[model samples]
Target: MAAVDTTLRRTLIEYGQTTLAVVVLLVGWEVLCNVLSVPKWLLPAPSQIAADTWEIRAVLPMHFGATLAAVVGGFVLAIVTGIPIAVLVVYSPFLRRVIFPFLLTLQSVPKVALAPLLLLWIGYGLHSNMIVAATVAFFPIVINTATGLESVDKELLELTRSLDASTARVFWCVRLPWALPYIFSSLKVAITLAVIGAVVAEFVGSDKGLGYLILTSSGAMKTSVMFGVLLLLSLLGIASFYAVAWAERRLCPWYLPTNTDPPAI
Candidate 1:
């Protein structure tokens, strides 16, 4: 109970600090824009963006839903494929040699450059955007999971072997638990990347989503609405990141890093 209380209190403090910082920044921005009399098209004040966001609320649901769907779909696909690839890479030297180089090369290619190819191959739409997101989000998960699986202390592995534990038992009881933290860490990163990937795909080829809205609004010189779309995209990314973090905490409560743990009282 005491530990739980400490953790909860620490979390509250961190959230409060973040909220205060954001409020201060927004207030400063609003004041600067008002004092300078900046035009809305050049740099929309937060107030103008907020007002425009409200006015566009009617159309927000559809565009937001499209982007959300693409993001989620792509993230899920990355997880589904990435973990298995990591496991294979960890357990099989031949597979690792064959696959890891390919993955590294693929990761180096800019997603924007590949987006057009994906559109051509997959056809433009939700599926293509989801594939783009998956491509962007895949590498971190694979690397992290593989690293975690390989990170078990050598002595611990020897001890497990001496105890005559089956491979499955060693993996289930030792390797998987150790990997959870790394996996979840990658998941948070991948989720944010997924959002960027989806937006990139939309930018390249799609007629829908917040990215499309931003593009169209910019072309129309509706900078306030473009800012509003950007704000919405940021919120979506933040919410997705926290959702992954919440899952991480729930699944691996014992894995807190030293830096993040609350100070001793």
Candidate 2:
């Protein structure tokens, strides 16, 4: 009970700090815009951004849903595709030799640069966005999983082999379990990248999503609308990242990066 209390207190403190920081930033932004007498089109104050966001609340659901769907779908696809590829690479030297180089080359190619090409090949729609998001997200998952799988203690592997454990049994019991933390860490990163990629794809060519809203607002000089869309996108990314982190904490309760254990009192 004491440990749980301590963890809860720490969490509350962290959230309080974050909220305080955000309040300070928002206050500064509002004051700066007011002091400068910036034009509404150039730098609408926070109040203006909030009003604009409210004005578009009716249409926001559909665009937000579309973007969310793309990000989730692409992230799921990356996990399904990347893990198997990682396994093959880890197990088969021939595959590792052939596939690793290709993946490296593909990673070097800016996925945003490929956005237009994706639009050309996949057409202008959520499909292209999903592809782009998966492209941006999968590399991290594959590399991290592979590294975790390969980095297992050599002594443990030798012991398992001495016990005449089957390859499948060894992998299922040892390697897969050992690699989970790395996999989840990569998942956290991939979720954020997935959101960015979906937005980039939308930016490249789309009539929906917050990204599209930002582009149209940019042309019309609707700074308030752009700020609203930017905030929405940031919220989406934060939500996605926290979702992954929640799963990570559930699966790896022993892996606390911030030393959640109670300190000496």
Candidate 3:
């Protein structure tokens, strides 16, 4: 009962803080717009954005689906490919020494600048978008997985060795479990990056997706619609983040419990 009460209290406090911050932001935005006489075209009020959301409800879902597909597809690809590569790198010191520098260089390259080239090569649409998204997210997963695998305590390794554990057994029983947290942390970061990548690809070349809507709306000075699309993008990011968080909670229940308290009324 005490633990439950404490958890509830913490959740309520967090909810109140979030609500306060949002209220403050909206109030400031409303005041600033009125005082500065900001043109609707330049900066539509929050209400206008809300109205625009309803106005575009019909088409918004289609665009959202397009972007979501790219993000999820690419993220899955990154995880599948990156994990194996990370395992290889971690298991082989020679491979790690030889490839780590190249991996760093590849990661440092500006993916946005390469978007056009990707479009040119893949010839637009979902393939190009997925490629870009996967590229953007791949490095983090690789780095995280490698870090997790390598992070196995030396003492743990020695103990396993003393027990005459095989390399595969050590990895499955000791290293992989130890690395799960780090892998999930990287995944959270990668998911957001995947969304950004999909949006960038849409901006560069695509008839569909939120990024394309943003481009079209901005060009036509449909500020309200632009705001709507931006809102959708923000929601997408939040949804992806929370999805990962939920998965972490389920898969790693030993790590932490979900805070379930409601805000004080």
Candidate 4:
């Protein structure tokens, strides 16, 4: 109970520090803009951005829903496809040799560069955006999951094998649990990348989404609206990342990240 209390206290302190830092930064920004008489079109104050965002609250729901759907769909697709590919890579040396190079090549190609091609092939719509997002988010999940599965303790493997455990049994009983941390870590990364990919796709070809809103706002020199959209994007990314982290804690209660708590005396 004491350990739990200490961990809770540390977590609260960390959040407090982060909140205080953000508040300080915003305060400084507001003061600087006011004192300098900064042009709103060039660099709007945080207050201006907030007001602009509030003004667009009605339209925001539509754009927000579009982006959210694409993000969630793409993220789910990446997870669905990435994990099976990782399993195949782990279990089949031939497939690993054939697939890894291809995957690396795909990863190396910038998603922004690939967005146009996806737009052309998939047409300018939600499907294309989802594909782009999946492509952007796919590599991390595959790599991290493969690494985790292959990283099981050799001694544990030997013990399991000596017990006449089948491959399926070994994987289910030993490897999967061991790999949960890595899988969840990849998920957190992939979710953010998914958001980026969706926005990039929207930038390339869409008439909708926050990315479209940003592009139009910039062309109109509505810097406040652009900043507001950006702030929304950041919130979306942060929220999704934390959602994954919360799931990780629920699913892998035994897993504790390093340095999250002070050393016990």
Candidate 5:
């Protein structure tokens, strides 16, 4: 009970600090906008963004839902595809030699540049958005998981081999568990990339989602609406990141965030 109370107090304090910082920033921004007589087209104030948010509340949800769906689909696809392939790269010399160079080449090519190809093949839809988002999030998961799998202590593996442990036992008991931190770290990064990927895909080809709305707002010079969309996008990224982080905590209770409390999740 005492520990719970302490945790509650700390949470309140942290939230208070965050709220204060946001308030100060908004107040300063509102003042600067007025003092400079900033054109609404150039920079809408926080109040203007809030007003725009309220005005578009109905449509915002639909756009937000679409974007969220794409991010989720892409993020899940990356995880399912990436981790197994990474394991293959770690375990198979032949596959490592063949696949790694191709992966690097693919990564080097800009995803936005592939927008036209995606549109040509997938044709401006949710699948295209998922592909784009998956492309953006794929590399980190591969790299991190591969590193973790390869970085297992050599001595430990030798001991397991000496014990005549089965290959699956060695992997489950030693390799995969040890790689959880790396996997989760990549997931956190991947979630953010997924959001960006969805937006980028929407920017070029789609008529729905936050990216499309932001593009539309820009064309109309509705800076306030753009700001609102930006805020919504940022919020989406933050929420997704924390959700991954929460999973990390559950999967890896031994690991703790640097300079912070263990996440409740």
Candidate 6:
């Protein structure tokens, strides 16, 4: 109970600090807009943005749902595809040696540069958007899973080997469990990137989703609506991040107890 209370207090303090910072920033933004006599078309006040969002609440939910579906679909695809590839790479040194450099090269080539080609290949719609999002999100999961698998304690592996554990058994019992934390950490990052990728795809070509709404609102000089879309995007990112974090807490409780108090740094 004492430990739980300590953790709760620390979490509340952090949340309060973040809320204070955001309030300061919003107040400053409003002040600057007023001082410079900035047109609403150029920079809407937070209140205007809020009003715009409230006005479009119904339509906004539909657009938000579309974006969410694409993001979740692509994110799941990346995880499913990446983890298997990671396992194969770990199990086969030959394959890892041959493919690691190519994987790195693929990751380096900007996904935005390939979005047009993807659209050409997949055609416009959810499929193209999902492919782009998955491509952008794949590398992190693969790299993190591979790193986790490779970083297994040598002593632990030797012990299992001495016990004559089969490769499949060793992997299922040891490697996968050990890699959970690293994979979840990567998941937190990948979820945000997934949202970005979905938005980028929509920006490039799409009639639906928040990204398309943003483009439309900007073109019409509906600055408040554009700001509202931006806010929705931010909220999407935050929600996905916390969802992953919550799953991590549920699935990997050992890490929290072992780490004890949060680090000062």
lDDT scores for all predictions? 0.94, 0.92, 0.90, 0.94, 0.92, 0.90
Best by TM-score: 5
Give a tens-digit lDDT track for model 2, residues 16-103: 9999999999999999999989889888999999998899899999999889988998899899999999999999999999999999
**How displaced is residue 241 in candidate 3, in Å?**
0.7
Greater TM-score among 1 and 6 belongs to 6
Worst 10 residues of 1 by lDDT: 256-265
Clashing pairs in 5: none
TM-score of each: 0.88, 0.91, 0.88, 0.90, 0.92, 0.89
Candidate 2: minimum summed lDDT over ten consecutive residues — where? 256-265
Off by over 4 Å in 6: 1-21, 257-265
Q: What is the lDDT of residue 35 in candidate 4?
A: 100
Q: How accurate is candidate 1 locally (lDDT)?
A: 0.94
Clashing pairs in 1: none
Q: Which digits, one per residue and each the tens of the lDDT, describe model 5 over residues 16-89?
A: 99999999999999999999999999999999889987998988899999999999999999999999999999
Candidates sorted on TM-score, descending: 5, 2, 4, 6, 1, 3
Report lDDT (Cα) of residue 209, candidate 6: 95
| Candidate 2: pairs in clash | none
Put down candidate 3 lDDT per residue, 172-238, tens digits, no spaces: 8889989898889999999999999999999999999999999999998899899889888999989
- In the range 8-101, model 6's lDDT, one tens digit per residue, is 8889999999999999999999898888888999888888889887898889888998899889988998999899999889889998999899
After superposition on all CA atoms, what RMSD does each candidate show versus the true structure? 3.3, 2.6, 3.2, 3.0, 3.0, 2.8
**TM-score winner, 3 or 4:** 4
What value does the lDDT take at residue 244 in candidate 2?
92
